[model samples]
Target: MSRTTFTLDDLKRILLEGSGVPEGADLRADILDTDFTDIGYDSLALLETASRVEREYGIELDETVLGDATTPRAFVDAVGAHLSAQPV
Candidate 1:
């Protein structure tokens, strides 16, 4: 039950690399703790990000958890939890 540790930078990268985020919208470090809506992410973008995470980590994340994630840390935590629960 080892969870793959993902950094904030990794989350940012996923957001940037994945589609739906406003083009050229800078995801500054200061905004990691900010709400996704405040940071300019729409629901579709979040869903896309979740899809990418699931595909990248090969884990099925809870949609409810992902939908409720307002900050990058929350998303990271949810993903980490899912990863940790995975069979080794």
Candidate 2:
């Protein structure tokens, strides 16, 4: 089974598991539009998150798209797009 859509909750879980949430970084808040950097996740953390997502979802993410996704919303949207394109 595979995911057909990417959600904020999914990103939150992967972030927490792949790279523990930083102290004071509230994943409980509405952080979809917040930049990952602003939420204590650096480029490295995002990379790790992307890796986890790729392995878990069995999909290869476009690095250029990932690089352009600065916020959770953008990241989620990017993943959702890929997921949507996958063969069902």
Alpha carbon lDDT of residue 67, candidate 2?
Answer: 81
Per-residue lDDT tens digits for candidate 1, residues 1-88, read 2237666777888888886356556676577678887777878888988888888888887768766788887888888888888877
User: lDDT tens digits, residues 4-61, model 2?
Assistant: 7779999999999989989899999999899899999988899999999998898999
- Cα-lDDT of candidate 1: 0.77
What lDDT score goes with residue 20 in model 1?
A: 38
Instruction: Give the Å shift of residue 34 in candidate 1.
Output: 0.2
Q: lDDT per prediction?
A: 0.77, 0.90
Clashes of 1: 0
lDDT of 2 at 58: 84
Which run of 10 residues does model 2 get worst, by summed lDDT? 1-10
Off by over 4 Å in 1: 1-3, 20-25
- TM per candidate: 0.83, 0.94
Q: Provide C-alpha RMSD values for all models, in order.
A: 2.8, 1.0
